[model samples]
Target chain A: MSGREAILGNIRKGLKRSGPLAGTALELCQTRLREHRPNLIPARAQLPHAGQVELFVQMAQEASATVARVTERAAVPAEVARYLADIGFAAEAIVAPDASIAGLDWSAAGVATEARHARNGDRATVAPAFAGIAETGTLMLLAGPQSPTTLNFLPDAHIVVLDAARIVGPYEDAWAMLRSERGEGWMPRVVNWITGPSRSADIEQKLQMGAHGPIRLHIVLIGD
Target chain B: MQITSPRFKQNAHEALGDAALQRALGNLKAGFPGKRAAAVARMPEFEQLRDAARDLKNHILEHLDFYLETFEANVKRRGGHVHWARDAEEARAIVLDICRKAGAKTVTKGKSMITEEIGLNDHLAANGIEPIETDLGEYIIQLRGEHPSHIIAPAIHVNLDQVSDAFHAHHGKYGKTERQTEPRALMNEAREILRDKFIAADVGITGANFCIAETGTTVIVTNEGNGDLTQTLPRVHVAVTSIEKVVPTLEDATLLHRLLSRSATGQEIEVYGTWSSGPRRPEDPDGPAEYHVVLLDNGRSNMLGNEFREMLRCIRCSACMNHCPVYGAIGGHAYGWVYPGPMGSVLTPAFIGVEQAGNLPNASTFCGRCESVCPVRIPLPKLMRHWRAREFEKHLTPQGFRFGLGVWAWLARRPKLYRLATQVATRVLKPLGGKTNRIGSLPLAGGWTAWRDLPAPQGRTFFEQWKDRQQAGGAK
Candidate 1:
């Protein structure tokens, strides 16, 4: 028998389920996974939409991320340019090829943009987030052809364009949104829930930013 | 990797004497607990969340076989492979096979306790494959050829000067020989050095914090994002986790995630909570081309059918150890294994035989602080007591202790005899105590007296006080 069979057999013997798993037991297991009910969401996460957006911005700042608000999608490039200049960075960055972000005119905003996966030497990366979670100020990015996962981690600065309308309260809501959009029982190769810029407290338990991922996380919230 | 748990006393003695380790340990004592306390005080529903997390884990462990099968099938559906290993040797061999198939000369590693448990690095090095540890703490320990003193903070036992010296000694060949004392400078130096390794590595290995059975997703929580970089840059990705790490659904992972960060660190959420389901998809622009997960059983299967089964509920928050007085005194290395502190004390005896690690369970004072702060409420003190009971039953405890307990038990059977024994001892001790009202030293109590004087028992026994209260009530 394979190692899988042996380990499973050991588990069965130990748990005292001597026979093959009966249909009822299997059904209960499947039902639990299928229903996937969330338990005890914090009261703070159950706020109204406006309250959520406010909390998202507040919590994001508390997590050490800078936030900018744009009244329209057309203003994203300008906001991006302003942020780059504010940080004294060159007006150039790699952007994800998501359709939501693909139509923006980078040159019109006076910023040079490369639409591809993030390269190791890339200093800044701009991608469109799948959703923004308000409960903890986390940005949810799914990995696929549209938004490569490397853009979230490889660059020193991560700039995300999140549609303010897509912001949700709890992580469960984000997962629910994921299922509704991508279909149940399906996910991309990866889903990154980035709360803030990378940090490390490994040395003497001192907080240091830019340990391995982006040092700065800048989010541009675009209103509907 | 060798079990020095049998020599816990000797290890703790050495650890206590090391001035550098003592200084580092002082920071650990002051660091994690207060942060956790503050985080808990901020969240009103934190206790409710702990209960929810514990119940979910208990439900999952009961149906783990079914969940594992479902997780395996889902992984296969996503074009990933799941390998099961009954023991550490098999697990190590499985990982090596993957590396060999990819013709990997070098592998970058995220911080993984499972890899350390299975001795994966040494095994890979023995097979001529160099493993680069990318996590800053793990990297420092790697340079010094030492094991992690603390699980989360691998270099928790090493002071800053030691880190600077290690970097200076090792990074000289990279043409950077300057000695830096600031933590930020050290972090930057390590980042610069590991950045090249991340790009050059052919394979990346990480440990899963939780595996979602519903989606075949492996979750890794890291503040440094080394795990993300390690898995993202390499062509092949492997997640080595034990069978117990699997949870039934994303909701379960969410609930545990809420409790884990608060208990482990003060963060409401860690910086990077990345979920990788499989290899890079067909339409994915970047990610590993191959993904594998090795599910290790070792002795966890045995732990499932017994009293110690609740240990599997651990989310590895390190809250228990952070609150443990014994751990704060001796640090992690003194426990002498891959794991340390209260959780390790209970688990070490289970993994290695009780005979080898019996001393670990005895090291506790049963303060219950570990259980109080445990995110999943694992009842750590109760489990340690179980180990102590088993040791006593098997005659593994010292004969003197057994005889002492036996004498106490004999006297306790008769209430009159017990009361007389205690009353006579109290009277004899009062005169000995004198004006200081403390015992300087006594036979068979050197352990307590050596540290400090014991306060004299000047008052009447509880039975006498209770009787007097009853008579006074009757008079009233």
Candidate 2:
């Protein structure tokens, strides 16, 4: 039998095993669809292109407010160097080597840039994802030539330079885009979808950000 | 050892009525739904994800037998044993045999609904093997010798004081005085206690959130990190999962994962999402020497090829439970089963005969909130109706209720007689309503009237008012 036919046959077997009751199941499915209507947020809001990224950055800032450190998105190597110098982390900040920042004159930019290697007690630098999700306000870091999952999670304050043009409408659209780009062979070992800093409400249901993951998140929405 | 649904009800009542339980339940009401809303609001694609997840689950359930065979074959190929259990008794027996063969003195477990269904812990303890619950909430319930109150947050009904007390009582024997008065302190105490058990455990048993057939991987999501230690540290790791937990491929698992965590606790993803392929791979360092996957039927296979096949699509995110007004009010323990809320109400009746669990189906208000919040989109309310139908067919309902329902149905079938009876009843009862137009007590609705006063009907029926309106059209 074909793959589709085999699948259909199995479903028949599963249904027989599970039992029958079509009328009841249909009614229940309809009821579920109705209830989630209000809770669902629409894809489009009345915000301008710049405002959307700014809104995401603002929300991330609010969610990660408890953390002591935060990074803003830097457009160029010079701006990145300036930010690091301002924070007094220029001497020690470890930079992740990705294609976006590869040709930028880092030596003239006046700060040390390190390759994407695991380092202790140094702030790791990496490129911001193409488009960040506004709904979860998540930073979608795909492991490729430019971005690594470790740079986003391991560092004290992750500095992500997000290009405003890459922001998509929804997560499914984003996944569909990724699937097209990545193709079918050997999927990335890690695709980190970071929503705010690592948080836990385990203790007395009090919202405590930064339990095990990153303590701080900084997003720089570069309007080119 | 067979504690029926009625027994669970009595136990839950005793637990839920306590002041501590009420306090814990209040925390749940404020925390879960609020966070879920915030998470969903931040992601515009969440609805699309939910739809995709639901479709994927429906597709898998349609071809579950094929997936099961593929999963079983893949598991065996990876040097993992696959056991198919036709019922709860068989499942329990299979697990017990594995434990007996290994001569497991002590077993450490992660949270699993199937184990609850099979009463594995109780069975093991009866046969003289100590099954230790390593999950913080599960450990609390285990110490108290009670079943999990909720699927996600097992001890959600338990307050901090109760947790402290359970720790004080159970921790002293482990050479530690329970100084923990706070939740974090209690968690720290548990972490330390369970750490030792994890290392010394001969067998580690956990429940799979999703079992991928393509890779023969059993996926488990937990925030506490206890499941990882339980599976990796032990010599033998046994995964007990229901048939519905199987998905066709890893990609499908990922799609479901995106929906599962969001619907479960409103997180983009859980803190830990681990996928165990089989017994420790040859190159792997520090993993289980022996891996076993027990695929349990327990009346689930019967659900397939039927109208209720959609029920198998459930990812067990507990979204339905969190949104359910009944569950919110009384908590999971009140449902009197491992799978609580709307899903449990439908499932319990199916697993243990509709006659045995007639009240479970009737417990709901048919508010449809549970169905709405469900990620895989199980039509729980309609399933409850099916159970009700079964109850009526089997004559399981109380004779008085059955007779009253029969009379009501007969009257409902004849509208003219129903209108006449209503008119006469309105006339008779209007005086008893008094000036306030409310009855202090209802005659037959004993439980309904016990809580609140019943509002009295209007003196004139709708039909009477309509007839008067028709006649008074200027006598035309």
Candidate 3:
């Protein structure tokens, strides 16, 4: 028999089932996947909207990402520039191809930006976060024509501009947002939930930052 | 990949004496456990989540056939291929076939214990395909011609000097000859060297943390972004994971994901939890052109029908080893297999044959720390005891051990004789501890007394002490 059939056979033998489930038994198993539900989300993730934003900021900072709040979308460039200046990075950066971020007048803030997928040599990047999870201070970025996956990892420093309105309290809430927008059956090719800068405690168990990904993660929360 | 578990006693003995290894193991003891405790303290519903995860896992295992078929169907729907292997040899053959079809001259790999289990890199290299490990720990160990000493932290046994030595010895070919002492500098040096390989690799291979049946997604939980680069940058992305890792949905994966980093490193969450479906969509600007999943059975399917079924619930978080006293003493290399520690103690016997790996289960002290820290609530100590029982039943234990147990069992069956023998032995051994009240050495017990002195009993045996107390009216 083929490996697939043999494996299935072994599994059925182990479970002591004669064969694959048929009729309602089969549907019962499939339904679990089709209509998946969250189980016991931490009570901490069930906070109010403003509380979620506060939690996200606090948790993100705890994960070692610098957070800054901008009062308006119009003030994003200035905030990004200010963060770059504080960190001693150049004002120029590679930006993801999102219209919301691209349309921003970065030049007016004296910050030079190139809108494209991040190249291997890019030192800094500005990407748009699809959602922010307050439960763990994670940013969920979907890979699309507008947002490239490379923008999340191919740089030394990652600067993401997230709308405070999209900040969520639970990881399930972030998934719910995707389903509500794209329907239950559809999914992006890649969904990256990044919490902080890349790190490794691999060598001697000594914690080290910037391992094969961004060294610095700076989040600019646009709007209070 | 090599089975040295038959010689685990010797391996552990040498490991204990290697001062450098002991120092590295000391760091391991200082790390992981505290972080896990802190992370558990921060989450009030941690136990609740663990309960839910354990049930979810048991449920998945019961319906394993249904989930695997569904996961395969979803991957096909997402324009990906799912390959099944009944054993490691078949798994390696299938991977080699994929590489050959891709015309791959070189491939980049993320940290995958399964790939290590199947010994895929050697097969690929033998076929003239260079395999590059992208994870910093994996890379360092790979350069030193060593397998991962620890699963999560692959180079946990390698100190800073060893890492510098490996980099200094190997990085010269890449035009880097300077020695880097700081961990950050070493990480950067690896990043710079691997970036070129990531972009140039013909295929990218990684292991899946969870293979979701709901959306045809393979989730990789990592702190480093190397896995993303490994899967995203190449033309073909191949994910090699075992059959038991398949879950029914994204929600199930998330629940387990929540417990993983916290238990492994005490982080609230690892930095990157990347979920990949198929290759990049037509409209997508970047990602691989093809995606494939290789489901390896090896011996796990056999384990499911047996008493060791609970081992399948493992998420490979390394918490078991983190708190495992035996693992802390000897480190991962001494386990002499792809897996080590409490979980490995159970699995190595089941997967590689008990006769060859029987010593592994015997290595544990049954402290139950591994089970306590286990997120899936696997009864690791109970399973190790089961292995010990199996070893005795199968007559795989050493002749000396069997003879000792046989004599003890004979006396144990006769309580009067047992009590008489113990009382006499206690009196005779008492004089040996006359001055120091500790036995310096004893006949046929040199192994126990060689390292340190064995404390002598201060007075009579437990039964005698209990009789005296009852005579004095102190017993309840």
Q: Per-residue lDDT of A56-89 in model 2, one digit per residue for the tens?
A: 6554555552212223233366666656666566
Tell me the lDDT of candidate 2.
0.69
Off by over 4 Å in 2: A1-224, B7-17, B100-103, B462-476
What DockQ does each listed candidate score?
0.85, 0.12, 0.87
What local lDDT score does residue B253 receive in model 3, on the 0 to 100 scale? 93
The CAPRI classification for model 3 reads as: high
Q: Lowest summed lDDT over 10 consecutive residues: which window, candidate 1 chain A?
A: A18-27
Candidates ranked, most accurate by TM-score first = 1, 3, 2
**Model 1: CA > 4 A from native:** none
In model 3, the runs with Cα more than 4 Å from the true position are A23-25, B467-476
Backbone clash pairs in model 1 (N, Cα, C under 3 Å; residues 3+ apart or in different chains), count: 0
lDDT of 2 by residue, B148-239 (tens): 87888888877777778889988998887845786656765776677678768899999999887766778887755567667766789999
Q: What ranking emerges by DockQ with the best candidate at the front?
A: 3, 1, 2
Q: After superposition, how far is residue B359 of candidate 3 from its true place, in Å?
A: 0.6
lDDT of each: 0.91, 0.69, 0.92
Q: Chain A TM-score for model 1, please?
A: 0.97
Q: Candidate 1's residue-wise lDDT over A1-224, tens digit each?
A: 99998899888888899855678888888888899988899998999999999999999999999999999998999999999999999999999998778679989999998899998899999999999999999999998898998999889899999998999999999999999988998888999999999998878888899999999999999993
lDDT of 3 by residue, B22-51 (tens): 999999899889989999999999999999
